[model samples]
Target: MTSRNWLTTLAAAALFPMLAHAASEQQLPSEEGQLTVSTVADGLRNPWALAFLPGEQGMLVTERPGNLRVVNAEGKVGPPISGVPKVWAEGQGGLLDVVLSPDFKRDRTVYLSYAEEGEDGKAGTTVGRGQLSQDLARLENFNVIFRQAPKLSEGNHFGSRLVFDREGFLFIALGENNQRPTAQDLDKLQGKIVRILPDGQVPKDNPFFGKTDVRPEIWSFGHRNQQGAALNPWTGKLWTHEHGPRGGDEINIPEPGKNYGWPVATHGINYSMLPIPEAKGKHVDGMVDPHHVWEKSPGISGMAFYDNPRFKAWDHSLFIGALVPQELIRLQLDGDRIVHEERLLGELKARIRDVRVGPDGYVYVLTDAKDGALFKIGLSGG
Candidate 1:
C-alpha cells in the first residue's frame, strides 16, 4: 500500500477510540485469545521518539531526518515544525528525541536532542530547549542548552535521549562518540549522563561539581552508546540501557559520579571481535552491574515506564523497544531489579525504534523504516 494511503486509513481509525482490556494473567498469550495491533499513523521517516502533550489532543514525534511532527489524536501527521537545528544527518546522527518540559502546562517549553554539525567536518550531540509556538505548529526561542565538548569527527554514537527527574532537572545521555578513550575521560562530557538545569547550568549538587579534574555536568561515565533511559515511576530511579558492540547489552541504574566501566570492563567484545577485559568480579565494588542484560544484542532503543491504569496488571514495568529483535519488551520490576521479561509483537516484522505509554494509557510504538509506521498495541480479549 502507498504510504499516504496507509496514513489516511490509520488516521480514520484513530478518530474513533478503541477500548482495551487487561491481558490474561499468564506471561504467555491465552490459547484462544489474541492481542490486537493497529496502525495509528504512517509515513514517518524513521520516527525516533513519541511524547504526549498535556491533554489527549495530540503528540510530538521526532523524525531522524531532522523534523518534528505533531501527530493529532486523529493520527494526522502535521507539517514539520520549524526551528530544528542543522544536524549531522548520517549514520544515526540526526534529530533524535523530543520531550515536553515537566511544567508544560505553566510554560510550553520543549526539549530536543540532535547531532549538531560542528566545525571542520566534526559533529557532536547537542541538547536544546525552546518554547512551542502559541499554535504548537512551530518552535520559537530555540537555544542550545548543552553541547558536548570537543566535537568528534565520527558520525555515530550520539546517545541523545532526554529525561527529567523529580527535581525538575534534565539528564542527557551522551555516547562515547566512537572514541573509546573519551568514555573514560572525566573532563569531557562525552560518554556520560549529564545532569543540568533547564538553562544548561550545572547542578550544584552534582558529584564532581567543584572538582577541578571532572566536568561539573558529568553525572556518571564509562558508557558506550546509551540509547534507552527512563525514570521508574515507583522508585524515581534512573534506568538506562547501553548498546554493546557484538553482544552484552546492559541495563544499569546510574548513580551520581560513578564509573560504569564500558571498554575497560565489558561483557561484550569489540565489533571487530576483539576481547575486552571483564570486571574484576561478577559485581564490582563501586561500579553497578546490569539488573538484566541481553547477552546477544537486540539493538535497544527508547524505553518508558508503564504506570498508567490502562494496563493495571502491567503497572510499574519497564517497556523497551528493540530494533533487531523487532519487538517491545516488558520488564517486570521489583524495587530496582527486573524480575521477568515478556517479548511482545516479534511477529510484526518491523524495527521497533521507540516505545511509549501514551497519555491515554495505551502503548504506542514507532517503527524504523524508510516509510515508518506508528502502531498502538492494546489488550483485546478475544
Candidate 2:
C-alpha cells in the first residue's frame, strides 16, 4: 500500500475496530438449500470485481477508487499492487474490472477496465493489460489496449465488463456515457460492444471490419449501460445485462452486427416517470428485444453462470448481482429461455456488485459499499 492508503487504513481501523476482522459466518435460506455466506475478506472500499488466481495465489480484486489488491486464502487483504494506471476516480469512474488471461498460467497476464481521462478533461472506459510480477506486488510493463471514443464529460455509465470468448476474442461492453442519443449513433463507440484481439487489435472478421464510417471494433450497438458480462459455457455465446432508467433491467445475448434498442425503444420510462422521447413503443421493428427483463429494475451489476456441479441445485443456473434490491438473483434456464427466477442474499441487504463461480464450485460475491466485503456462498451443511 502507498503511504496515503496506509494512513487511510489506519484511520479507518481506529474508527471501526471491526475493519481488521472479517464478519462472522452467516447461514441463510435459499430456495435450493440452506446457503452459507462467509466473509472471505472485508474493508474493501467499493470493490468492483475479483478474479481468482491459479494454484494457491489467492484472488485479485479491484476497488473502484483505483486500487488493486490480493486477498489470500486466509482472508487477509494485502497492500495494493502497484502499476495500475491513473484513473478518473470520479462518480462511477474508476478501476472497475479485473480478469486473467485465458492462458494465465503461462503468460501471467492480467487485464483491467477502468475510467480514463482523455483530452479536454473528458473521460471514457479504457482497457489495459500487464504481466503480474512474481512477487505479486506490482504489474510489469502495463499498457492500455483499447479506449472508448469521444470521451464525454459525464461521470456515470462507463458500462465496462471484460469477457474473453472461447475463441480468444475479447469483448468489451461500453456505456453511452449517460448520453441517450449516442445509443443510436452507429459511428460512435458509446453504447456498443466491441470485439478485439487479445493485444487490442481489431479482428478482421468483426461485423464492421471493412465498413466505412463505422467503428471496426464494434460487434453490437444500442446498449444503455451494461455492467455484467460473461461467456455462456454451454453455447459459447456472450451474455450481458444492463441497467434501465425506471424499470426494465434486461439480459441480452449480444451477437455480431446486432442492434439492441436502447433509447429508441425501451421497456422502461425515464427516471421522471415520463415516456422516453426517442421510443416508439416497447417493441421496435429494427432492434432486438432483450432475452429477459425485470419489470422493477434491480440495478443489476455483475453476472455469472453456475455450471459447476458441487452445488447440484445451482448447477446450470445464471447468477446476477443486484444493486438496487441488494440481492443475488438466480435465474433458472431451460435451454435458451429463462424458466424461473430466485432472489438470494436479501438478508445481507448490501449492494451485490460482482458475482463469480469459484474454482471450488462455490459462488462468490462482492458488495458495493464504503467498506465493502467479499463473500463466498456455498451449501451450508453439505
Candidate 3:
C-alpha cells in the first residue's frame, strides 16, 4: 500500500495520534463513508491566503512576512516570487490575500490585499493587481487599485478580503481601523465594502456615485472587521463574516447600499467587558440585521462555499476558518439560515487562517503560525 493508504488505515485503527502529526492524517464521518485530512505542505512561516493557478501552474501562497511563493502538487515549495508590494508587516498587517482574476487563465492577473503605510507611519488596508511574469518570478505591471482613505494608526484591524461579482467587479472588504465611528461616516472609506471595476474605475451604478463628499466605491457600510468573504454559488450574492469585540461575530449577505449594524448595535460588549456606549441593542430602525450572528466570537477569518462534487454531502455547505477557538467550521445552510454546524480539524489544534476548495474538489486550508502549514482534505472509504 502507498504511504497515504497506510496512514488512512492506521488512522482507522486509531494509530494516528503518533504517525500522523505535522504530516498528519485524521479520519471523520461523511455520507460517502469516511473523510481524510491530509497535510500537503508544511514549514511555512505565517502563511495567509491561497490562490490556485491555471492548469499545471501549481498554487500561489502568500506568507504574512511579505513573501509570495508557489507550491506544486508534489509539495515542493518554490522560492518567493519577486515584486510583491511593500507591506506594513506589523500586528495584523502584512501580505494578506491573493486572488486571481476571473479571466486569469488569459490575463494572468492577480489581486492582492495588504496593509500599507500612510503619511506619518499610520497604516490602512490597500488593494492592487499585478500580472504574473511569464517566468513566474515577478509581479509585473503592478499598480494599486484601491487604498482606504484617511489612513489611521495602530495595526489591529485591517479587515481585508477580496471577491468578484458576476459582472466582474471587484468587491473589497475593509475594517473600521478600530475607529468605531468611522463606520457610520459617509466620507471615510474605512469600515466599508467597496466595489470597483477590475481596472480601478468606479462603477457608475455605485450607491454613492454622484454624491458629494463621499467615496463613490462604497457598496455597504457599518461593518466592524470583516475578514472572510465569498460569492454564494447558489444565489450569486456576496456573503461576509467579521470579527466582533468580545463576542457577536456575524455572517451577513449585504445588499447594495445597505447598512449593517456594527458598533452602533451589537450583541458584543467592549473588549474591556463593558457595554458599548453607542450600542442600541441588536436591532435598529434602518440598519440590517446579520443573516446569522455568533453570540460568542469565533474569530472567523477566511471562508468559501463547497459546491464541488468531490464531497457530494458537503454541497451547499460553507466552510470557515477560526482563530481564537481554532477549528474548521462547516455550516449547513438552508437558504440564508444556518441549519447545522460541524467543527472539524480540532485534532490538529492549529489556528486556521484561510480555507479554499481546490478545482480538483479537495478542501484546502492554511494554518496560522510562526511555523505554519498548508493542508488538503479529501474523502475515503468507498
Could you list the CA RMSD of all candidates, in the order they appear?
Answer: 6.8, 8.3, 5.9
Summarize candidate 2's per-residue lDDT along 187-246 as a digit string, tens digits: 889999999999999999998998989999999998999999999999999999999889
At residue 207, give the lDDT of candidate 1.
Answer: 96
lDDT of 3: 0.86
- TM of each candidate vs. truth: 0.90, 0.93, 0.92
Local accuracy of candidate 3 as per-residue lDDT tens digits, 1-382 = 4666555444432421211232557786654466788787888889999998765566899999899998865667889888899999999999999999999879999899999998889899999999998778999888998999988848878999999989899999899989998998989988899999998899999999989988899999999998999999988999999898899999989888899987888889998999988899889989998888889998999999987644567768999999988888999988877999988877778999999987666688999999999988777742
Compared with the true structure, what per-residue lDDT tens digits does model 1 show for residues 1-382? Answer: 4566456435533542432222221222522235567777889998899888765447899999889998876677899998877777888798898899999888899999998877777788999988888687888889998999878837889898899999998999989888887888998877899999989998899999899978999999989898998888888888888898788888888999888877676667767786764434334556666767788999999898887655446667888998988888888878776788888888777998889877555678899998998887766531
Count of backbone clashes, every candidate in sequence = 0, 0, 1
Worst lDDT run of 10 residues, candidate 2, spans 12-21
TM-score of 3: 0.92
Worst ten in a row by lDDT for model 3: 13-22
Distance from true position, residue 32, model 3, in Å? 7.4
Which structure is stronger by TM-score: 1 or 3? 3
* Model 1 spans with C-alpha error above 4 angstroms: 1-33, 277-286
Clashing pairs in 2: none
The C-alpha stretches of model 3 lying farther than 4 A from their native spots are: 1-24, 28-33
